[model samples]
Target: MVQSALWDFLRGQFTRLPYPETTFTDQVVIVTGSNVGLGFEAAKHCTRLNAAKVILAVRNLDKGNAAKRAIEEATGRRGGVVEVWPLDLSSYESVKAFAQRAMRLPRLDVLLENAGIAGPPYRLAEDNESTITVNVVSTFLLGLLLLPKLRETGQRYNNTPRLPHLVIVSSGVHYFTKLPEQSAPEGKILATLNDKATANMGDRYNVSKLLEVLFTRELAARSPLPSQAGNARGKGGVIINYLNPGLCHSELARNAGLGLKFMKFLLARSTEVGSRTLVHAASAGEETHGQYLSDCKVSRVSPLVSNDTEKHGGKLHTRIWDEIVRKLEAIQPGIMQNL
Candidate 1:
């Protein structure tokens, strides 16, 4: 296992994957956390590919404007090709408000749930661990909230040949997480994670990513699109997938200590390179739906993630999904109705 990890790390550091050349002409795309780092680079790539509108969903309006200006200047695509939208993932209200505003868009072709945090000290937001709340709960809330719009876009252009994409930014670190044991009872897993005494801050982010993987798989399984005549399964109405950017140099680790900083400097890929994986995943075909992508391909995930049949009977994924929906419903009443 250690050797496998080392090989993955080395491949991420040295692999020169090509940036995707998928065109986004006339497409409207939204990338969260777009003010800097991987998000910013992805937004830039979208503009260069000629996306009609690229919404920079960010926490800070000032920084968002700066990023917009920089992208416009770099791509020479002015006249509001890139718009700045405020989005604070830590707050449920903020996410709701942003989703409401997004409903006004003429079309939303791609929704990239890219904003996330890491390595901060243990903190609670809205009665849940900060990482869990932002990365898993709020991220899905926003994704669920936007699903109607994505589905609408697909239906509106069903004959025009289009596939609306929802891409979640996950990490390879999820492979390291082991969620609560199956014998620990049904709802205790989330409770254990929320408990301050038992929760491990260092591992919380990894666990959050694990939740994302499970959530994506369960969501795909439960929400398959209607099949055509004589076909076993139809194309997914909204293609949702998760990807790992592979230890990129970014602001995600700014709060970490010196040891992490030095290690990052030595092993991390540039944000530009890492963002390519995001673009590629966003542009990929239905074969990638509900899959965990790495190094710009559909790679093998960890056994813990892949082996749901072990001991727990295959219900682990369903139980976790139910818990997430319950928690999300508490925050955004009737939100699941949209999904």
Candidate 2:
């Protein structure tokens, strides 16, 4: 652990991180669902950081284009190649199509898998999985499809070493729930200390995040072994990691209804504030690779996800690896079959 004084000093330095000296200029960053909310804030920051091209990978092109214009106007800069591409995570074809398009880019610097939906009532994705479907399975599929390109960025810029990063935007709720190996009943199964009924939305969101955390650890562990001994090693192997942006009042939560949105608006931080953790995770120096960060700093995770009590404290590293792999194969048979 960093000493308290040193930690404070580091944080102070981070506040100035967005200045002219070390932004992501000349880099291509693809942020999913970047039309609004936290995604929009992230894209905005990328431009401020001088990212060469920030693609707003949104589900709706119209809204995304508007956001691109708004970001450009706000930043007082134009012609930086900020644009939008359609992406619907619930569909495998959409993810694959997006991946194929991304492959055409000369370099893919940061892939922010930030698009997600909070399951309001019980719902199923096009794949017939629960609403956690978008948060977990769909995002997983997108990342899997884009993994090769993400890794290629590292090699494409090997001389300067502008490595690629995949940031899985998770949530603080991940610590509150277990990953559902089998689907659980939807809606309000638990209660908070105040006697308020916990909504099923919380359950679905939290469980999905847990699965994401496990998947990141597993993907990083397994991807490197398949490279041929003599070929340019690590060419298609990426540093996959998870990030919890904490609670933020973004457009994603407005669909929960005005009351819910209002409550979040009162308690949640600004989108730029929320975007800080993700930006750090996406572009911090080499030491932060594969690190799980919360707030604006990397911190310890919950015991259920990172710790195993019965095995003399060895990490539960492989506890959910096989299960997720099995599910991924079933979800996207052709895309994941070989892996």
Candidate 3:
């Protein structure tokens, strides 16, 4: 966690992730925020690999349709193998609606939670800060809502070569963030983030990534990843994992300071190159369950989330998980059953 920022950035720039070649033939996949950047590129990859249906879940239908057309033309495959669907993570109702629609899918093989935002000027979405609401809360809301579907797909597709995956697009920025907001009083972690007086926009994105890492680990712990032996006893089936795509050439940092923009131009990978890891993580097998990935390989996390220690001091891990579960349960009663 104490590595030089310059060294880390330079390393990420030079070490490339190989383009994923995994075939997703006939699999149903969803990539949220697929209208542009990494999400768009990842969805394109899925289409190229022959996924039966690639759902482009976006906030804007126009952009989503445009992306769908572009992908269809690029792949020279038509007839709706790639479909656009409305998914505005900023609203709870929108996320719920999206989940309801997904439930009708014959099967869902992968869900890449790629939508997120950085904050500077304050804004609220639903019951929390816009970044927290969209990035952490709604992201998980959709995931939790569709957990039963993912589990069901595992059983339904048991004979197939495909595996179910729920991959979240987290970031290595989490390693640099201390997540000071977490120091707030018990049960006030998210409340403190919503407090404009206490909210630190300077590091909101990083903090959100840290939360994603924490939440993914906790969920995997509670539900347990499907085992390689098969979903025996229904103990494990879907592979739930998160990854750090590193600094990529994308619009995700559009709100950052000018200096940061210059740094990104010099240090970031291409949008296509960065998204390779997304495809890789999605197709990776049982070993990746609850693990953090970087550059297409399992990687280390900051000590705050390091698995070497049980629960990273125990209390911080459990307290944060408790707070999130409470909020999620409030949003969707009996939601934990899906996990």
Predicted structure with the largest lDDT when compared to the true one: 3
lDDT of 1 by residue, 1-339 (tens): 747866886777788878869988888999999999999999999999989999999999999999999999999999989999999999999999999999999988899999998875888887688898899999999999998898788777665345788999998888776765334678767777888887788788888988888888887666565452233332338788899999889999888889878988888899999999999887887778778888998987777766784656657788788889999899889988986
Pitting candidate 1 against candidate 2, the one with the higher TM-score is 1
lDDT, candidate 3, residue 116?
92
True-structure RMSD, every candidate? 2.2, 6.3, 1.9
Off by over 4 Å in 1: 159-161, 180-184, 225-236, 309-312
Candidate 3: the clashing residue pairs are 226-236, 226-237
Candidate order, TM-score descending: 3, 1, 2
Question: Lowest-lDDT window of 10 residues in candidate 3?
Answer: 227-236
lDDT of 3 by residue, 1-339 (tens): 466644665786779678788899879999999999999999999999999999999999999999999999898879989999999999999999999999999999999999999859889999999999999999999999998898898887787675689999998888777888767898999999999987788888889888898888888877675554444634327889999888888888887898888988777789999999899999997789889998788888777777424654657667778999999999989998786
Residue 166 CA error for candidate 2 (Å)? 0.7
Residue 172, candidate 3: alpha-carbon lDDT: 83
Cα lDDT for residue 82, candidate 2: 92
**Alpha carbon deviation, residue 289, candidate 3 (Å):** 0.4
